[model samples]
Target: MNKISIGQSELMASQISLGIMRMNALSVEEAKTVIETAISEGIDHFDHADIYGKGASETIFGQAFKKLGISRDSVILQTKTGIVPGIMYDFSKEHIIQSVEESLTRLQTDYVDTLLLHRPDALIEPEEVAEAFDELEKSGKVRTFGVSNHNPLQIELLKKFVNQPLIINQLQLSLTHTPMIDAGLNVNRTEAGSVLHEGQLIDYSRINDMTIQPWSPFQSGNGKKGLFFDHPDYLELNKVVNEMAKEKGVAREAIAIAWLLRHPAKMQPIVGTMNPDRIKAITKTTEISLSREEWYKLYLSGGKMLP
Candidate 1:
């Protein structure tokens, strides 16, 4: 596995991370197998969210991790907080502090390598967030801070008050879901692809030296439908991906992930597959490098047109 420095921090992690969102559905033994498989493939970073499986995922992961007997410092654990399910998004100092405390208890750890605000709270108060971060940092509960699904201005709003450098901004990016990349490529065009939905976050992250963590790397960009691997709308994309996989002697999943790694942004894709075989296959991404021509071919095949 290839290691990339997260943001400006000294923390170095695998270019691809395993997301434990669905770990709640697995028994302790099964979860252990999934985690062990990932670690064996050189994946040292694990991503989690407080809202995942209603905290059950974290509990299971904690149990499995303890059974493995691995040193805490050997792996990086990151979790997101602030979503209250059906209630509302909360960024209050009380919620932020309390959330991490609860997460620590469930994760079986005294501190997390990183903590992220799950999603942008419409009623976010920068001062409150800053206070929460200050207390967490001083107490050694969270080593680093970041945000997920936040736009450039939203990140700037938090940076205005939060003292810690927001080292990461996790976003959804895939070959089929290319709004961020499309906007940049279609600049000044009258086409729908010219609409800048994310405020050009790809450029913003690179300019600010913040790492962009791409989540849902294989999604079809359509809700609840499933991965793009065999999605009907993505037949062209599937063809290109399969051809590349055959040429490179890798699994189709690696070609999809390799497309993300081909970007200069150096995004760390969070792969959420729980299958041990899939985990092994996906890790093969590190061995293959997508050329510029091949990268564009895959992109164009994903129902995108270049001006």
Candidate 2:
């Protein structure tokens, strides 16, 4: 597994992340086996969310780790908060503080390696969030800070109040679902479809030295959403992926991940498979580097290329 440095932090993370959102459904022993397998494959970072199954995911992880007696220092746990069900967004100092306390208890850990704001809070007061993060860091509750599904301006807004360094921004990215990349390239004033990203988030992240964590890297960018496995719009792309997989002697997933890793932006794909075998096989994606032309062809194929 290729390692990427987390800003100035001592933590070095693998290029791929194991997302434990579905671990709540798995038994403690089963969950432990999956995480153990991931760690064995040099996957130390685990992505979590407080609202996943209403905290069941964190509870399952906590119970499994406690039973297995895995040391806290060996792993880096990252979880997000600020998404309140029925209610919109939340970044209030009280909410951030309460959420971290709850997350720590559910995860059965003294501190999370990274804490990301799940989504942007419309009424976000940077001061409140900054204060919460400052206290969390000082209290040894959270080691680093980051955000998810946020654009460049939102991050800028948070910067005004946040004294701590925000080094990671997780977003939805795939060869198929890529407005962030395509919008800037396909410039047409008359076409409404040309408006992509509405913000230059990818470039902003790279410029600021923030880690770009791409989730749902295989989703089909078509009429249907989140259906990347054998998706119709993804046929050509999957074909290329399968072909490359055979050439590289790795699984098809490796090809999909490579498509993202091959980018100049150096994206870290957040892998969500619970299967240990899949985890080990997908890490090979980082090993295979697709050529520049191959990456572009796949990107153009995802869209009806304009003349």
Candidate 3:
């Protein structure tokens, strides 16, 4: 795997991050296999969230991670907070502090290299978030802070008080779910105003040097059902992906992953698969390069062009 600097920081992280959200259902032995497989493939960056599997995933990892007993410094432990049972958001100082403590307890770690606010809280108090982060940083509980699914303005709003740099933003990205990638596809039209987050998240992160970790890189949902891997509407795009994969002698899925990392922004595509072979395949994007024409061909086939 290739290393990319996370955000503006000098810390180098693997381009492909591993998500352990689904391991809650896997047996301890099974979880170890999946995690160990990732380690074998040089995937030391693991993503976690507090509410995943109702906290069962963290517990499972705590056990497996402890058993493996890799020194805490060897891995980059990143997680998120703020989505709870009520479908509401919470950036309350108490919740943030408590959440990190619980996550550390569950993940068997002393501190998280990065903690992301899961989503924007409509009523967020920048000061309260600041307060929580201040303490977390001072106590060495959280080394860095960022947000997930947040836009540019929201992050700027937090910066008014958040003393530490919020240097990362978790985004939902896939070959088919390319709003961030496609927002600028049409510049002369007024419709660009209607795009979610206004593409500012991508532009802002790039200019500000924030790392973007994309979840669900291979979901078959962007066309008939919704990003462009398996849905019926993307048959043509799929054909192109297959053709490119055959030409490059790599898996189509690997081609899909390469398309994202090839962007100048240096996005880190986080995969949710527990499959070892798949993890090995996707991370190989760090080596493959796509031609500009091949990249745009898939995007155009995903949508109507000149129609």
TM-scores vs. true structure, each candidate: 0.99, 0.94, 0.94
At residue 235, give the lDDT of candidate 1.
88
Backbone clash pairs for candidate 2 read none
Model 2 score (lDDT): 0.84
Count: clashes, candidate 3: 6
Highest TM-score, which number? 1
Number of backbone-clashing residue pairs for each candidate, in the order shown: 0, 0, 6
lDDT of 3 by residue, 138-161 (tens): 999999889899988889999999
Query: What's the best-to-worst order under lDDT?
Result: 1, 2, 3
lDDT per model, in order? 0.94, 0.84, 0.82
What is candidate 1's lDDT per residue for 82-196, written digit by digit as tens? 9999999999999999999989999999999999999899999999999999999999999999999999999999999999999999999999888999999999989998998
lDDT of 2 at 298: 67
Worst ten-residue run, lDDT, model 2? 189-198
